[model samples]
Target chain A: MEKPVSTSPLGQTLAVSGVSHSYAGAQAVDDVNFVVPAGSIAAILGPSGCGKSTMLRIVCGLLRPGVGKVMIGDRDVTDVPARERKVGMVFQNYALFPHMTVAENIAYGLSGLPREERRERVAQMMSIVRLEPFANRLPRQMSGGQQQRVAVARALAPRPALLLLDEPFAALDRSLRADLQFEFVQLQRSLGITAIIVTHDQEEAQSVAEQLIVMNKGRVEQSGPPAELYDKPANLFVNGFVGHASLLKATVARADDGNGLLRLASGSQLAMPGPVGFVPTSDVVLAVRPEHVKLAASPTPGALLAKRVLSVPLGHLMVHDLLVEGATPVRAIADRASESAELPRDVFVSFALDRCRLFPAP
Target chain B: MNRNGLPFLLPMLALSLAGFVLPLALLGVFSFVDTSGSPTLANYQRLFADPFVLSVLVDTIALGFKVVALTTLIALPITLLYWHASPALRRVIVFLTLLPMLTSNVVRTFAWIVILGRQGPISQALVELGLAPAPRSLLFNETALVVVLAQIELPLLVLPVMAVIARSDGALSAAAQTLGAGPWRILVTVLLPMMAPGFLAGWVLVFAGATTSYVTQSVIGGARLIYLPQFVYREVGVLFQWPSAAAVAFVLLAATSLIMLAMTAAARHPRLAGHA
Candidate 1:
């Protein structure tokens, strides 16, 4: 079905700049700045109480920032009231009105329209969410996923300029959450809505976002494509937050011609990549992805031998924890298909030099 | 189950059966009986024929509805105030609102009479301010009865409505505002629908209580405005007519029950259920 052409013009860009907010003298969001491009999904990934939701509220005009401005397209809506902002939101709990039926809930936001138009729009939204069969049922009568769909339909009924979702699938079970994630992605694509979602689950954020902003303690630690952030983190926090990794303490032994040797605490020396910009004798922490480390039967040159402490099977992969030369344990993900003939208690672990990132020790 | 537990529950069940169900059943039986020295329908016949009895019954029903309407009108703002108020302010407001209900109904009725009677505080204040020539009497009127009845039942109306509003998720209203609903529209379209059940419960309760109340009505309205309860009291106590008084009591009981039944049915209707 064709949506009514937006006569007010479309593709409004939202920019939040230098926004800071506090509650009772404790900062909740501090100097956070990011721009959501027109017709793209921006996911804010953070731990609980990291002020991602506070930032979303600020952008949606629900809360005013202490210092900074929010601009949508050309209008500075920092002080505008929430009702006039035309920003639709889907709450974490779905927040569908339990007292209203599916159709009534959908029509609630369109109350300004003519009665006949409101009815038509509600029918249109019900079909969009594929809830026509349960349109007359109250929210309490529907399942969790169905209620979530109704909430989305209700928020989208008015063709809001910017759509905000606060952990929209947090209440759903794993299977339902995955299915709704795909459905939401497809719906967002079809509607071309510029949307922002705040979630603590990294995988969920990575799956739905075109660009991910990793937030920590009321600040943006890093922002980039999910793959880029996972492959090349800008800081120690993003390195651990984006995916599973093992950190190893190491010191640069010698440096010459843009290449150096890193000495581990276990008295093992490994060749470092030339691109790692660090001086000789400098201490740095090495971040290595679990999948990057490989187990070999025989010791290759420059490879370190370690005793396998335990092998935990996780579906198709076995994660082996190894004690390297009596030092701290390191973990590697070995494919179960290839590790079927495993019989060795000791193994050599090695990784390509380019796979490791070096950060200065605190 | 323990035998000792059975003894506790048995007495409660027996008391409820005797104190409540038995009285209602007796009233129903008396509603169909006669009192003209024979097993005829003369009592019920006389009840329907007397214009004075019919007028008093109508007046009672009308006053019941009037009190319910006024109570709801007063309680809506108070409930909203309690809902959005700061915690400390809410505590104080709630305490003050309930202060009236905690007092004896007879005492509150007398307080209203003192304020509304001729040469009373309100009448004297009006006279001194030249709002009226002398102390004008405001008591012994339907308006005074309704006002006093509403004051007595205001807490009943406010508590339930405020409880519903307080427990509401609040997220739905926030979502409505984000969807472009102003405060007024959000109240009417979202908050009110969610709170309809509590409002209906309060209205029915106050209406039932006001229809059956005698103290407030008798004290404020006096003998001039004869409600159904006062009429029944006059028949039984003043005229010493027991059978006729029983017949009038049965009529009032049936009317109040039917009104409550209709309200319950309306509340359960699909159209209203959709909103609530």
Candidate 2:
């Protein structure tokens, strides 16, 4: 297939509003609504079977929403069929046509264009994915990463308004996954095309996307910038899913103007701002990220006593598991350093008050 | 074969030798022998010189082609349906498709005789619908034989195709759809090429079964249609020329196997799949 005419690299905003879908009467995607700004990479992150893939399919028009609509740029395309939707998809398995060559696979969707133009477009797409040297190779003859790039090139050759990837790097190894993720992010930014990747790996999502959507069960848990979702989760599920965090049980022992003296299970009272929808003496859970737990040799006013259990060193990050007297384990992460090698058996750990999220029991 | 599998295969090997190999060897010997048990090629020579035998041979080949065509036409769509059918519907379809295989061919042919004979349901329907001037026999015709043989061999044509479609995981069609191809183009370009192996297998199975079939030809076709298998039956039963019958049977077997070999070779050819 030849190359298509050089269209504008600028992409359009994709809006999925009031979208919900069910399979065999069980909900798969529930009332999902999110707007992805044009030319930005967005990632929908969730565990397996958490409806992240379902949401991507609906946005690509692969699966029709039971209710609400989808819009690409300013056009309402909810009623449009998958072929007419102009949204491209790279499947989890790369689904390149087994019988077609690299160039032919890229040219499949470009049949509407002239033959020479389609061929030229295929060549350009191959070079964009750095697959020009393997233009005649079958998908089976290429490596996983090469096949993945071919799939991406095939999806992009038609100049679709929006692109969807379902677990794009799942079939790759850990090292190859990161490399391809980096390449994909770079290519997407250079092309200035809207991309929505569905993955269960939060690190991959965070590394590749500017906007992140965390989903659970059949609903969106949170949708915002990756940093915001990591720093300030809206709920317990998001807090546990997006990053490593330990949730501790607590209750408000005293309440004052916009503040509460929360008592931990260890019987230590830490004064913090009062949480919404809860009164004094109400049981609550506090989400404290590992990085926020500061360790000290001596007991501080608001610190809790814990015995060090084990420490794991990986790259620059060191994770220490410390157990309280009542058998509750609290994990803290600190950067590895020369001076931080030896640790006391008994250490005082204080939670960063601003970094913790106080919430009711899920 | 492993030790355990070797034991399991003993029964099949013994049965094939007793049932297939021994009989084939005997048939070969008898084809070149005279009534006095002396070896001679006179039987084969006389069999080939008869124009009637040639016509029957051509008709049987033509019938093999028609049977394959009709079975494929009826079975391919049904196979696709079974591939995508719901669990409950799939079970019912599988059971229905295998119903003809349960009974012996002789019994099924007897039932077909009653149905395609005069005053049968079809003739009655034709009379009631005024499609025919009056109720008459629909039996003993090429159309009747084709429909009956297709029904008999339909499962053979469908099961292989169903297996292929099941393993494909709907990936090719989904890819085609995402690539802007409509349902028709996907069916033509993606599906048919991939299912070529199943199509060839089913065609060969049905062709061989229908070509060697004797009960259906004798019962439904009666004396009107002189097919190869019927000619062999007559040479042995009526004319008492067992040598000539054996010679004709050998030729039929050789032709069927040769055609199957050619068909398989063509099906596996890479160029057929657009894999340039």
lDDT of 2 by residue, B1-276 (tens): 458778889999999999999999999999999999999999878878989888888889889999999998998788767755877988888888888899988888888888988889999998899899988898989889988998898889887777666655466677788788998898787777667777888888999999988889767787889888888888889999888999999988888889999887876665333331
Scanning candidate 2 chain A in windows of ten residues, the lowest lDDT window is A1-10
Residue lDDT tens for model 1, B123-158: 999988999987788988888889889989988888
Per-residue accuracy of model 1 over A6-64 as CA lDDT, tens digit each: 34344478898999999889999999989889889999999999999899889888888
Instruction: Specify the CAPRI tier of model 2.
Output: acceptable
Across A318-349, the per-residue lDDT of candidate 2 in tens digits comes to: 89998865567889988888425477989888
Please compute and give the TM-score of the first chain of candidate 1 against the native first chain.
Answer: 0.94
lDDT of each: 0.85, 0.85
The per-candidate count of clashes, in order, stands at 0, 12
